[model samples]
Every structure is written in C-alpha cells, then in structure tokens.
Target: MDSPHGAAVKAEDFGLKGPRGWAFRGVGIDAAPGSLIAVEGPSGSGRTCLLLALTGRMKPTAGHAEVGGHQLPKKMSAVRRIAALGPVSGVTDLDQALTVAEQLREGALLQRHYGAPVRAMLRPRAERRAAAEARIASALEAAGLDLAALPKGERTSVRDLERLESVRLSVAIALLGSPGLLALDDLDLKLSDTERAEAWALLRSVAARGITVLAVCSEAPADALVLRTGPVDPDAPDAPQDAPDAPVEAAEPAGAEGDTKNDTTNDDTNDDTKGADDALAEAGRA
Candidate 1:
C-alpha cells in the first residue's frame, strides 16, 4: 500500500506457560522496525503461542513486550490495533467456504469498518466503496497475488487453493489493514523446496516494504532474525505450577470481557498431537 511505516518490536524475558508446561519461555527478541523475524521450532515448541503473544492475540504470563509502540498486556488493545495476524489457526483462519474474491472483499470491509477513522466512515457511501477498492488493489499488487492465475480465478474457494496460493491470499488480506506489524503461522508448512524459497522471498519483500514480519516456521532461514524455543525445565525454580489450560483467544471488542478456564487434560491432548506430528516427520526423514 503506502510506503512502509513499520514500528519497532521488542520483548524481554517473555514467557507463556500452559498447564502442560511452558508453551514457550525465556524468550527474548529485539527487532527493529521492518525486520524479518522467524520463530523456529518443531511442533509443540510453542511457536504458535509466541506468534499470538507478539501480535496481542494471546496474553503472556510473565515478562514484557512492546509492539508498534504499545506496551503489551497493559496496552494490548492498542497493540492489537496496529498488529494483524494471518493464517494464525485460532486467530485469523480463512473461511473455507468463501471464494478468494469474497475473502478479499470481506477483509477490506472489516478493516475499513473496524480500523478506519470515524471521519472516514462519515464519507459518502460511493467514496467509501472506492477507497476500499483502492486498498484491495494495492494489497493485491503488494502481495503479488494474481487472482486470475488461480484455477477458477477469484471465484476459487479457499478449500481449493494450493498451499502457496493460500499463503498469498492470507498475506493479501492481512495487508488490507495496512498494519505496522504482521504475524503469520506455519510459514513453511507443506511446501516444496521451490515453494519455500518463493515464500521466503515474499516475506522478505514484505519486510522491505516497511512492515515488521513475525513468522512461525519449522526451521529458520538464513536471512531472518531467529528465536529458538525448547522444552521447559520442570525442575527449575521458576517453573510455573499453574498455567492456562488453553491459549486465550484473540481480542474482543473494547471493554468486552471473557474468561479462559483451565483444562489441563485438553492441553495434554494438544501436546500429544504435536508430538505425534513431529514423530511422523522424523520418521519420514529417517
């Protein structure tokens, strides 16, 4: 869209614990505005949790972070306003039933209605519609998504998109908000070597445009600022005895409140699933 106006992102001693263990802990990152950062770890290592925590989609139990000039936990609402999530399973998942064009239209509309200034909303209907179209066009161009290249063009359902196409679509939608920081999950999941290269290049281009990018990947690429996560040391004195059973969901409307209950058993199931997936990958490599 417009020239980059990326905001600096920083975290110190950031940690998030769940009942199963520390989803991620002792994490620290100092990324300048417009930097490309990769959170690298195998499944169950809490990469997703880290992504959510940085984007203000999940709360951190300890430590502190600043995103887009907003202090997290304290100014989470403000952080959420300047940061956007793409393809974060529980946070920004695309609707499978929708067509690519439909998704783009909806994302632009949501951004305009939820993120635009009140003065902008007071504009004439035709002008607002035109502005939305301009934004979608800019995002599409910047994301390098050619909707017409898809099998069914813009009418292609999200369920039908190839892995790379889905990634591009999600990036395009996230761009509609013109956010200062963007977070994406599963950056390299299910992609061939060539596709992986393309994805990395795309992300690099995004960073070059002035949007700080935080991505979750199974392995970090050579070009990114990397953060590696490991299993929690239970014997450590700082180990948390009580932790959230599940991750807190994304932000609700301002002033809205919700409670997250502990379900340690469910947490175990999630851990098991992640472990199994990691095992399968390891076996395939062997």
Candidate 2:
C-alpha cells in the first residue's frame, strides 16, 4: 500500500477503439494503493490495450480513469511520469542481442537523463555513474535477482535469459525509474505452474513495498483483483501469443522516452539497439 509513494487506480466506463473496431469497452475498476491488478483474458481480448491505457502509454477513446488522483487522458503526461512500463512488447521488449549489463547500463543512462531530478542530472560523470550503479543494485535486490547466478553473470544476453529471469530483469529496469506504479505485459506467458506461482509471489512482495502492480496474463492468481476485458472462447481458433495490437499506437522506448505518440517499426528498433550498443561501449571505455 502507498503511504509516502504509490498510485491508486480507479476507472469508470473506460474504453478505447481503433480504426477496425473497439479494443475494449465499458470497463470499470477501483484498486487501492499497492494493489496487484490482473488484466486477465484470452489472447486477442485487448488485455494489452487495457494495460497500456491504464498506464498512460495509450489513450483511452472513452470514459475516464485516474492514477494517484491524477486523471487520465487529460493528465496522461503527468500519469506517465509516475507510471513505468515493464516487458511490454513493441514497447519495452529487450533486444535479444544486448547483454544484461548493457541493458541495465543503457536504462540507467536514460533514467538519469530524462527522469532524474535536475540536481541529480547535474552531477559529474563519475558521480552520475556511481548513482546509476547504486540504483541498479537497489532495483536488483527488490526484484530478487542476482547476477552471480547467471552462467555469464551480467554478460548473459537477453536471448539466453530464462522466462522468469526476463521478467525479473524487466521489473528491475522499470524499478530504476523509482515509479509509483509498475505495469507489465505477458506476466505468465511461457512459465510452468511452479514458476507462475513464483511470479505472483514476487509481485506480491513488490506490492508489499507499496508500488502498485498491473500485470497482463491469461490466468490470474486468487490474490489479485481480476479485471476481465472479455471471456475466453476455447472453441475459437488460437491466436499467437505476441501479436501486436491492430495498428497499435507506437509506445515509447525505455530509453529516449518522451511520449508514446510517435510511430515506430522494426527498422526503428534496430537503430535503437545499435545506438545503445555504441553508447554502452563508449561508457565501458571511460
């Protein structure tokens, strides 16, 4: 729960639509500070859309919502400042080519550049670097992740990370922002029953520390507040797990982030990865 920091979420008639049809409609919810909200629904059920809408990454075409008492749609930019995205595909996906250390370093640089206070940003390069390291250490501890456990430790590539490890890494990266609300997509995608339980437990612990969590999954644990966008139709044909929303409004990158209104594609993503790689290499030399 939030006392000093955290966001409460409330919505009334929340909905969004694209050119093709309605993404989601007529949804309402009220979650206290530090609540674990599960956006549970089958694939193609607009779960991801709802998740983005709540986090101020995507605009809602209808009704109103609030985060930490800051209203949505109208107060989207303010909402974005306190809400951080984790593991949202086409939004915050990890580059398979980048190692764990590189990812952390790049995110730290961006967090300091764009999200840190003016005084913090004015620090000398060495001091800034040390602060980043401390932030990474604190985030990793909160995420229950240890680099020493990996085969190559910090050098492990994103492609080589286990499903749960990826989740933890994503959570850590977002936590680097010191957000009041953390939102993640595809929370239990490829995990076994045991791993699924562990994921929920980690989220619960994070919530215990007073940061609200919003997770998207096909199934939600009993402890979370379930917000269903639509019912699962087992009879219908299956949809691919990671299909992007139809004409999805482009989302901001974890680095160089400003607003999520710009359009981006695969080619744009490659450029970002190359830029991060170059920056990281330069940082390593210094």
Give me the candidate number with maximum TM-score: 1
> Each model's TM-score?
0.85, 0.82
lDDT of each: 0.73, 0.73
Question: Looking at candidate 1, what is the lDDT of residue 91?
Answer: 47
- Per-prediction backbone clash count: 0, 0
Can you write out model 1's per-residue Cα lDDT over 1-286, one digit (the tens) per residue? 5565787999988876645556667788899999999999877767777776787656677778898788866766677777777666544667999999899998887777677777988999999988888888898887889988888999999999998888888888888877788788888999999999999999999999999999989888998999986666766655342345433444321112232222122221224445223322322222
> Which residue pairs in candidate 2 collide?
none
Displacement of residue 43 (Cα, Å) in model 2 is 0.6
lDDT of 2 at 76: 70
Model 2 regions lying over 4 Å from their true place: 1-4, 231-257, 263-286
